[model samples]
Target: SLDGASDNETKSESGVPEVPVPADDTPEVLNKALSGLSSRWKNWWVRGILTPAMISFFFIIIYLGPMVLMMIVLCIQIKCFHEIITIGYSVYHSYHLPWFRTLSWYFLLCVNYFFYGETVTDYFFTLVQREEPLRILSKYHRFISFALYLTGFCMFVLSLVKKHYRLQFYMFGWTHVTLLIVVTQSHLIIHNLFEGMIWFIVPISCVICNDIMAYMFGFFFGRTPLIKLSPKKTWEGFIGGFFATIVFGILLSYVMSGYRFFVCPVEFNNDSNSFTVDCKPSELFQLQDYGLPPVLQSITVKLYPFQIHSIALSAFASIMGPFGGFFASGFKRAFKIKDFANTIPGHGGIMDRFDCQYLMATFVNVYIASFIRGPNPSKVIQQLLALRPDQQLHIFNSLKAHLTEKGLLPLLEEAA
Candidate 1:
């Protein structure tokens, strides 16, 4: 009776309750059993485990995360460099790079323009074709990029000369570009694996997974060698962590998503005739889709990552990703700092957390671009109807209809 009462209490949707029916299957007992199981599982891992598990979960959301993440990364990179400079300023401080305080914005522009050129291009193309307010940026991204690179390069090369000790300027100014290339490409590649989340998130997931696993493995099984730099880490734990990534990657590839033609967690907003995902499905209801087709009307989620891709990519991240961490450790060893900074308990500095991601991004990016890019650049995945099927020719009409509805396109065009 208590079991029946409890079941009714839990599943009841309204204040008025219907009479409980006795059946061959004791639903009340089943409910009690499920509740007990849930209680046990909840007790199995407390907040410490749950918190990281959740971060690791979002860490998996990087397929469509670049637009937002790299922007966020702009801030993180500055803070990271700030931390590095505070710790290791002796090297570049003497060199005198013109470390612009607002460099993050400039860096973001370069990064966004470089990797997401297609969307950015189509966006502005739509804008100008429609005779919209902000339309000039569509025609000449390359020219602008080329000019910026040229000017920055000139400054960098000048710094290499004997008279120009502009090493700092050369390093950071160029460093910004270098970072833009490496990280953005890396993200693009990883993002391709699922096409739903942003690519940066995949590498970030692998790195965080490796970190958490290494810690758990080391904490419980502390006898073996995890790696050289991280003395406490054990090989047993490391292997275990790697397996965990494989499992999660495999599982995450199977989630419910409607936006990606070939990715995970991608939310399909049909208005733009392209696949893009924000943080969650709720964001689709925001002001962005006015001109776009409703996601339900035009979007649908298809196949998930089969065992092969998940196994391969996760394995790749597990093995090669660590090299990035090792490299960071080597850098740390050279400087002799224990942690990046005591920002998070148990977790070290953001750089320390992101070390593997920085490295893994390159590996992931190259693989994706190669796989997706066809013999003809324009024809890359051209056989697929998604990107190539657009009937909208005039850029302005498209922009006014597509981007202006989102309200973001106008702002980005104006800012650019």
Candidate 2:
């Protein structure tokens, strides 16, 4: 009876399970070009072609400088938010729900206003003080941001219909989660950029290098699976990518450290009415000699301190960054989707490409705050500039006294 019932169910069209389409997005030209190859090889070719294009786009963004890069990050964040929110809407089948989408976007604007306002107050204090309206905004930015968010909250509550109450709340939770993942992480990325492009670029490049190297190794020599969450991931790929990314990171850091434009923290220049990257290099960017180990005492080594830090960053990118991808994979599986969207040809969506990037951004931000960033002289100067003349004079006298007590004033005076 059981076998007969199983046969009947399998025979029924509605009972048949759906399988995910692996490479449904081949371009017409590529499709024809790869017609002679099997599906596996065709996918490899497609990814190989698109991967470099994405990296090239990244290079172009870097060439455009920090402002353009910031704009691009903002755009990607918004796109990722949209992709996630759209997925939530589709999952809940709440197309008919009123005001959820509007509220989601409104909250996004409020959050951006808050984060960017803080950034302006922190880094562009002179500009804010020069403009009366901006000064006023900066003075009460947090309160205004909270008020805006509250307004969105109230609107969301008012929009709730009786029958749609549960679904509406679920969407509310979904929107907040999306904001947490997309907006907050992107804000950290902008923060990392301000520290230096090296901070922003190096960790991100490590992740990218790992992703590419792992995929290449896996494609060619995968034998054992790495994780059940990502079936295609392999142990060989993991090991190979770790070493590759570490070496890539160290070498890249060495190259970037020599360029002041890449090493200097970005700051607003009051004289030029624009941003500048022209500060003297930090100790991290300076090369230092190290004595060799007992076994290799005959040899000497010189390296930028940043390169040593790169090993840690690269290790995290290779080891932990893939977990972000795995988490995304699990999420997609839960939703019964092959990809986030049909946005990128070989990649799934902008979010698909950026899921691990967001994780790397957060990590870099924390790493800078914890280990790299020091007492910022520019920030201290900015604060002093904002004070009354008497207060500034008081601070100057106090600093002089402190230096004199330490017996360093004579040396400073002589140098001056």
Clashes of each: 28, 0
Q: Can you write out model 1's per-residue Cα lDDT over 1-416, one digit (the tens) per residue?
A: 54554454344323432222213222344445445456434333332544565576454544345454445555565556555544433333332335332343355456555545544444334434345443355456567766765665565445453333433444455446445544464444434443444344444565677667765765676688767876765788778888988886655544422344323334334357454545443232122222225855665443333433456667877788777777777766755555666554334565666667765666665655665334543223322322223533344467578877888887988899
Candidate 1 CA-lDDT value: 0.52
lDDT of 2 by residue, 208-249 (tens): 999999998898889999999899999999999999999999
What's the residue-level lDDT of 126 in candidate 1? Answer: 40
Error of 2 at 320 (Å): 0.8
TM-scores, one per candidate: 0.56, 0.91
User: Which candidate leads the pack in lDDT?
Assistant: 2
